[model samples]
Structure formats: structure tokens, C-alpha cells
Target: MRTKPIRALATLAAMITISSTALLTGAADTHAADVHAEGTHAADIHTAAPPGLESLVDTAVTGYLKDDRIPGAAVTVVSGGKPVLTKGYGVADVRTRAPVDADRTGFFLGSLAKLFTAQSASQLVTEGRIDARADVNDHLREATVPDTRPGRPVTLDHLLTHTAGFDSDLVGRNKASAEDVEPLAEGLTTRRPPRVRAPGQVAAYDNYGYALAGQLVADVSGQDFPAYVDTRILRPLGMTHSTFAQPRPPRIAGQQARGYRPDGASGWTEAKGQYGSWSPAGPGAVSTAGDMGRWLTDQLTADSAANRLMRQVHYRQDPRLPGLGYGYEEWRRDGRTGWFKDGDIPGFHSTLLLLPAHDLGVFVVFNGDGTDGRAAVDGRNLIDRVVDHLVPARPATPEAPRPSADPALATYTGSYRAARVSRSSLMAVEGLVGAVTVEKDGDTGLRTTGLSVDPQHGEQRWTALGDGLFRERGAGGATLAFTGDGLLVSSATPATAYERLTWRQSPALHTALLGFGLAVAALGAIAYPATAAARHLRRRDPHPRAARAARAAAAVTGLLAVTFAASLAAVVSDANAMMEAVPLGSPLLTAVTVTGTALVVTTLGVATGAMAAWQRGWWNRTARVLFTLTALGCLALASMLLLYHLVTAPLTWITG
Candidate 1:
């Protein structure tokens, strides 16, 4: 680890802090903007013709949409609080062939819902009801931090900043987020608690935390979170079409664009499935581009009190990244100082950008295609170019000092075991002391080096909470506690406590697991001989049903073969953890182990049934047993390889 000291500078000392998202942390996922050019010429506002600007914008937007094969787009340009251009192109619904127009009802905003989160949060701040710096534990009702660690409490500021130290999984739990989108009670409790960095520390993006914030809004405002937004921010701005519609809205329900993966992967089969309860966190909101344009106009006018609230940059931000602050439902980016958000789901993608300084904004929606190919980035860039043509740039702000490293935190570092029962445990060992390297999966570990000892998150001692529960300060991020019977707990979620097992990697345990997998596979393979004998008998009888069964078996076998091949490849070439490594190595360990075993078990069961059916044939029974064993052998190899990958591979690197 580097030993250089990072002394905070006076000019841009606080600005050097790490960031989760370019905007506020709890805000929704959206696109990022780039550097702005300084404006030289001025005073063209009164002219009938904006001088090459309209043609350039129209050409850029039209060309991009046509080239990208976008289904529909809503382009609106607001110049100095006046609607200069508002037009819709193409169709919102391709199946029904409905053309998207200015009044094209409702549309899902994807992660753009984060902007509303910020807005809702800012309203609380405006009323002096919630302090941003106060610990969030104080505000939360259904869920609370079990034991508040020393230093500052996990404040609203921390949650807003995404420096609260929760892992990304805290947000990505599909079931929980979807469930949370239900009425607040069901939706709020579904989320797994977070464990990563501590509150008010380095940045870690958390979408789930924002969901929690929405719940907090409900708790504080004495109104539903979405309703409050409509009353406070939306109603004031005349954003009539926009609503924090729970689950979904009826207006755009039929026209809503479906979400998709990178390919034609069979994930989302419908335009609208369940986003779970956390839907309010993101799924609840719906709006049209024309309405969004009105919202943007409200934000950039600067004359309205709401717009002033939107432009105030609360966080000390770096100029390089645009819109990196948490204000009253507003954020700044690229020195142009604007408000923006984007939404994405299977077949639909939407973006809304509002540049306050230039009174220019744009909204786009593309539906039907389910692939995130060239169009996503190109579409975003095209919007920026439109804004660039209209907005004037300010002087370049002073850049923050180069960040440096801290070395002391390297002391408390080692592998910790986390059972499915408790939070994971960390043992401070000397050899691996340079970096606090924890395996995210068996193959890959997230290494954080050069940490300083702070009394808040990191002190020099470990305190036992009770019942084998222990809490350590110097560890950072996770809590170490004892629960019962020589077992230690180390999980982040309070709802589900995980205990650490002493026998993490005993040779005997591994051998037993491997043996179990082999046995199951063997058992299944053994049925093949009996199956063949049964087939022969059925063939003699000329049973059409038997023929159908044979075909089904063939198809299943083919599919299983493909699965086995993929599993084999993973076992051989992929690292121990195909994704992130958990304490047991890779989650694939469980998948392969269980799936292989199940296959073997099913084969064995079939073979036994076959034996009962053809009691007269010795060769049939023998062949069945042998075949079952062979299949088991194949599965055994795959299972062992899966284990090896979980234990000895690198991170899947999906995010990077």
C-alpha cells in the first residue's frame, strides 16, 4: 500500500471526497453529463430566429432517432421560461401502432424516479422537520440500526450521499424491492440491511436506501410518500401527468414500455410485471415528456421559489462531474446547472434533462427494442448536444487537490467467515495486513487498502454485544457479534442474523459435500439402464404415451446436457466465484451442488421406478444402475469444478 499522506487542501479540501452517484446518493439511477464550453456571445434572446440553434437541435435529435431506430421521442426546448419547441416523434406503442404525441398519456421513468426521491427528501428539509446530518436511525420506524456505532450516526446526509456504507445488493434484491413497492408496511420490511463502508464515509451507491428514504418520507409527512410529492413538488410545478403511482398507473399502463436485458434474454416476458414493493422507490412514478418539459421549465425558471430550491447546490462538488449535489429536489451538472433523470425497463428507455441556465431541456423515450446497444449512449449524447447549443457556460471552477492514501487501516485485515446465519467475521491476521481484502466470491475479493484508524467506525478494540455477539470498531463496515453456543454473528441485515461457523473449509466437510454430489449424480445416472429397458418393453407394446415420454426425456436430456456443458465450462475456466465470492466461495457452489444432486436423485428415483416396472429383466436393472452411476460421475465432475471455481477464481467483474 502507498504511504503517501493526503493532506486536505484549503481551496478544494472538502471537495475531494469520494462520490457514489454524480448526483445525491439516494437519488435514482440516471445518465452522467460532461464538461461545458464557456459562452462568449450573448443577447440573442429577443430575436425571432435563435440563429442556427433550432435547425441544429432538430437535425441532431431527428437524425439520432432515425439512425438509432428509436420508436418515439419527445423533444422540448424551454428558452428563458418560454416553451420554444415541444414535439413528439414516432410511436409510444409499436404493437398497437400508437404515435407518440405531446399529449401521449403516461410513461414509466425508470430510475429517473430518484429525482422525486431527492425532491421528497428536500421537502422535509424545507419544513425543518428532518436534518440531513442527523442519523437516519432516528427517523426510521419499521427498520432501525441494531447498535449505533461510535462517530456520527448514519445521517440523512449519509443516506442522501450514499456514503452510508451499504452494499449494492442492499438495493438489487429484486424480490424485496418489488415487495417494498406494495403498501409501505410490506415494501419497507422486505429490504435486506446493508453492510459495506460505515455512514458518512467513502461513497457507495444505494438504491434500496433511497427506498427507505421514501418510507421515511411517509413516516415524517403523515402522508403517503408519492402523494406528498404530488402535493408538494408536482402540484406546485403543474406537472399534472406526473404521479408517484404505486405499482403502476392506469393512464400509461397499456402504453408503458417494457424493460429488457442486454440481449433477447428471456427475463422480462411482459411490458409490465411486478417491480416489487420498492416500486415507490422507483417503480411508482410515471410521466409524459410534455409534462416532464413543464416540470423542467418549473425547475429552470429561477423566478419561482421552487426553482430556487432546485438550483441550490448543498454538497461541495467537483466541477468535473456534472450535478453532484443534494439540494431541494434538484442537482447541478456540467456548470450549466440543470435538473435531469432517466428511466429504463425491458423494452422502454426514457431520459429527461433540464438546463436551468439556458432554459433548455429535452425528453426522449424509445420503446420496443429490448437491447442496450449503441442507441443508449448515443441517445444521451444527443440530448447533451441540444442542451449545449442553448446553454452558456461559466468559468471553470478550481479543481480539488489530488487525493492521497492512508496506511494505518491496513492493521485490522484478514479473511472472515460468514455463515448463512450471521454477519461475517473478520480476524486480524499479520501476513495479510496490508489490505482489508474480503472475498466477494470464492474467486475474487474486493480489496480496500490504506485506511486510517478513526474512533467512530474504526477504533482499536472489539466489544462483545452478547450471546456470542461481538462488535469491533477497527474492522470497518460490518458488525462482529456473538449470538449463541460458541457461534459468532456477522451479518448486516437485522431481520436475518448470520452466524460464523468455525469449520469454514475443513477437508472433511469439502470431501463430504463432494461425495454427496457424486452420490446424487450416480444415483440419477443409474436409472438410464432401467429407462432403456422400460423403453424397449413399451416399444413392444406400441404405447403412444411411452413414445411421448421418450421424446420428453430426450428433450430434457438435451437441455440438461447444455446446462451441464455450461456448468463444466464454468468449473474449468471460470474462477471459484462466478459472481461475487461469499464466504463459502461462490454462490455457484450451491447452484451446481444442488442442481447436480437433484438430477442424480431424480435419475435414481426413475431407475427405482423402472426396476419395479420391469421386474423380470436383470440386464435392465443392471444397465439402469450403471447408467445412473455414469450420469452421477459426469455431475460429480461438474460439481467439484464448481467448488474449485468458488474457492479459487477471480471476481466475475460484471459491474466493472
Candidate 2:
């Protein structure tokens, strides 16, 4: 018994040592995996975002990039007024194995740099150096505003407000180089007579107007517009990484992502779009997420005179739309207010959103213009989602639903709107599916999709907590709460909620449903004949049991073929619509059809031979081989489709 206890003790000690070794080894492997996952090969680097926010950030980015097959993307976010999340995802250059980084990622701010130009203009007003309403002519010597009426010469206010009636697509204004500028008067005449409404009658967003605004900065300050912004706006904010250099400055190195365009048949090919040095309104500035966060912090500092100046509602109406108010460069979207700007070009799509209401900001720069307007708009919504999560404190009654007596919901329900709203929150309790539509004229309409409210998700319903406040879902999968000021503020994360309703449609949606039905019918017609032929041969075969098996195989093969064909057709239709051409025979279509046909042929051979070979050894062997080949082929084709859909398909509306 003494000897037995000693043996037991020794065994216990050994187990302990083994357990410790296993844990240490496991830990080392995990650490190594993390490092490798985030390692930068020079073309792109992937790093973990700050904890808690990583899933949200990664999911959003992965979906956005994969859906568009973007070569790479750089992302960052601010939490607690500090850079909490800064990371790069995907390859910067596939051939080079280069890693993307915050410091080196190069993206066109496009028109988003307008916020900087506008901020600089606002700063001048704060310093008593410029007037928001002064005659732009006073600052001009070589260029003059095109006079549409004898006495109604466009004023500085008119240009700043985008109501100068200048054409937005001023192509010639963007010269071959940023150093080139078409004469201001020249840009006006080559186009139709200026469509000048009464000055300030409508707030039209014009690239040329912003370019003119940039020019005014130059004429008044006696400095190039790019230099003026760098000194007066960027440098003051300590944004060292932001620049508008014609050729990118040397300081920005290694981590920059190359811009690309979808080649006609070449697929995702590279291109260098216009870079601005002369035309400040359009594509000129290059920036990264870390630098942009610094700029946003400076813009949000209430103590700064620049912030106050920027908040001034100069035009008091959305220059881009009616009813929405314009404050210097920022826009007032109903009760919830924020500064918003977006950029788009051949190879890039970018956006910046500053929610002054909650001291929150989000900036996104994508490698491709895949989503067009929807990407920027959706990016802002994602920020709002993050903000909501950060804003609301846990309710005291944790396990209980928010009470009906909650005062916050009542205060939030008043007629509030954004210049461009996504959804109306009037029916906050009903969720999106059943929510009533509030028309432009403020009329209520029924939800055409029917009502769908699930309180369990906390995502699809308005959950009433205490204090009259309610948690509501935002467009970006974030939550928002009604503030006492009649604004929908993010409950946890920092965000501003706008009420744009342009995405809502009844007639267009109906047509889409009808198209889907037609597509399904067409697919069934194409597949039925193959299925019938296979089923008949199997049921009437020489061997009764084998015939039954063949019939089952036929049914499965026919179903699979039909489903694949329908999905392929839908993708082709969507691609055609986007490109404005029937892509009759592309490499993409060829790949899909070739793979599907191979499977069909293999299936037919196996099903026919299986029934014939029930008692014949030779036929059975052939049938078995065919079955194995068919199974292997299916797996290979699946792998190829996954790779193509996730990497190179330019317009994948189906997956998107």
C-alpha cells in the first residue's frame, strides 16, 4: 500500500508537468498566430483592431472589401476622444507582398477634402481675416464669377454655399496637372448659360464652387490653396501625415495602397486618377485614418474659435438639398447635426463624418468605388452604430424591457429630419418592417413589406429603457437613443442620426420581386428536361434497386444545376446593368458554365451506368469511377467559385 501511494504521487507530479508544458506551448502558438496574422509583407499589413471593436470593424470592412473585391483597405476609429482602433486589412500590392499601414496608406480624399477647405475658410472668418458674405470679386484679380444677371454678380457667400450655379461636372477645370487651372470665366461659357436661380434660392453642391472657394483662399491670402490649407488647417491640427503634394511626398512611404480600376476584360487593373494641387475642390489631397482622427479632434474642440466659426449656419439650408441647413461647411440634418463630406473617383471612394452632437467622428477610405454613394453613406451609418453602443449606460433594470413611461421616447418623437434621411423613426416601437413611412411632405404611409418586430435582437426593435429614452437600431447595425433635444443620439458609440428616406421605394421594389420570380421560372424550364430524362432511365433500368438509386441521383443533380444556373444568370444580369452592356461571353461566364457542365456530364454517366451495372461487374466499376470523379469535381468547382466571388468578381450584387 505504501509503494502504491508513492507510485500514485509520482504519476500526479508527471501529469502536472505535462499539463504546464502543454499550456505554455499552446500560448506560444496563439501568440505566434496573432503576430503572423498581423504581419506586414510591405504591400499590406493586417493587425488586430482594439479589443471589443475588432469584430465590428473587421466584419464591416471584410464585407465591404470582399463584396467589391478591393485589393486592400486601411481603417481606424476614435473612442473616448482617442485613437482606439487603427489597423490595415488585405494586401496593398499582391505581387510585392507589401503591407498597408496607417502612415503609408494613400487614398484620394476626393471631395472629402472639402471639409478641410471649408474649415480653413471658417478659420479665416474667426480670425477676422475673411467674410462669409463678402463679394468673391473683391478677392479676385485674374478670374471673375460668371455674371448670369447684370447686378447679381456671384458673391463669396454664393460660392461657399454652392448656389453660384456653376456646373458640378466641371471636367475642364481639372487640368492634366493640379498646377493647371482653366480660367474661371472660361469654365462658365463653354457650358450652357449658368443655371442661376435667385442667389441663395437653392443650396446646390458644386465642385467648381468649392474650387472657386479654394481659389478665393489663394487670391486673398497670397498663397497657393494647397499650401494655405496645409499651414492654416492641417498644421494647426498637428496632422503631419496629411498632404496634397502633386507627387506624393517622401514622408509617406511603404504602406500606401495602389489605386485601381476594373479593366474591361483585364479585370482589376491599376490606374492613377487625377491628383489635385491646382483644383482643391476635387481629387487632390491624400490622407490616412490616424491623421484624419487628429483633424476631427481639432475640429470638434469646442474651445477653439475655428469650431465656433464652422458651426455658424451661414446659409441655414442644405446646399445639396432643400430644408437642410448649411453651417459654413457643415450640414445641419434636422435635430441631429454633423459635418459630412464624401469623395469619389475612378479608383477611390472616401468619406468623413463628424458628429459634433456626441463628439464622435468616423472616416473611411476604400481602395475602390464599388459601392459608389452607398459606401460613404453606409460608412457613416456604421459609425453611428458604433457610437450608439458607446453612448448609452446600462439601464438600472437590466433584465426588464424599457418601461412605457420612459420620457426619452416622447421627447425624441417630434418632427425631426436630416437633409438626407435613411429611415423615419416616427414609429419607433414598430421596427423597420412594420414602421410607417413619413413622406417628404410629412404624410404617413404604410410599410409595404409588412411589419417585423423582434425585441430579442435589440437590433430590430425600439426597446424602451428607463428615463423616457429608447434604444433604436441604426442603419449601420448600431443603436441610437432619443436625446432630450429631439435628436437621435448614439446610445453608446458616438454618432449623429440623419433621416434621409430616398432608399425607400414601393414600385421599384415590386419590379425587383417580379424579376426574381421570372428568373426562377426560367431556370426551372431549363432544368426540367434533364431531370425527366435521367429519372425515366433510372426507374426503367434492368435492375430495380439500382433504378431507384439512379432516380434519386437525377433529382439531386437536376436541382443543383438549376440553382447554379439561376444564380449565374442573376449575376450576369446585374453585371450587365452596371456596365450598360450584355457581357455575352466573358472569362467569368465561361468559368461558371464549364464547371457546371462538367458536373452535369459526370452525373449523367454515373446515373445511367449505375442502373445498368447492378449485376454486371464491368459496368459497376465504371459507374463507381464516374461517381468519384463527379464528387471530386463538385468540390473543386465549389472552391473556385468561392475564390472568384470573394476576390475578382467586379460587380457581385448577389454576394453583396
Q: What Cα-based lDDT does every candidate model obtain?
A: 0.43, 0.46
lDDT of 1 at 284: 46
Give the alpha carbon lDDT tens digit for every residue of 320-396 in model 2: 22122122334333235566666654455666666776776667776543432134444555555555554443333
Q: Which parts of model 1 have CA positions greater than 4 angstroms off?
A: 1-58, 148-152, 170-181, 247-270, 302-323, 327-340, 368-371, 392-656
**Candidate 1's TM-score:** 0.54
* Cα lDDT tens digits for candidate 1, 1-656: 00000010011112111111111112112111100011111211222435666677557655554454344455556666766666555545433445555545465665567667766787687678887778777787776644536665677665655455554331122321233444654555654553544565343344556677777777888887778888987777777767775544555565553332121212112233225455444554677666776766666664644345445554322212222344222333244555555554434456667665565667665542222233345455667676666665454457622222222222223332322111111110111121222211111112322222211122223333222223333322233333223222232222112222234433234445544544444334345445657877886534345433432343343344334434433432311111111211233334433444444433443344344334533344554455444444444434433433321212111111
The alpha-carbon deviation from the true structure for residue 109 of candidate 2, after best TM-score superposition, in angstroms, is 0.2
lDDT of 2 at 338: 60
- In TM-score terms, candidate 2 sits at 0.52
RMSD of each: 16.2, 18.9
Model 2 deviation from native, Cα RMSD in Å: 18.9
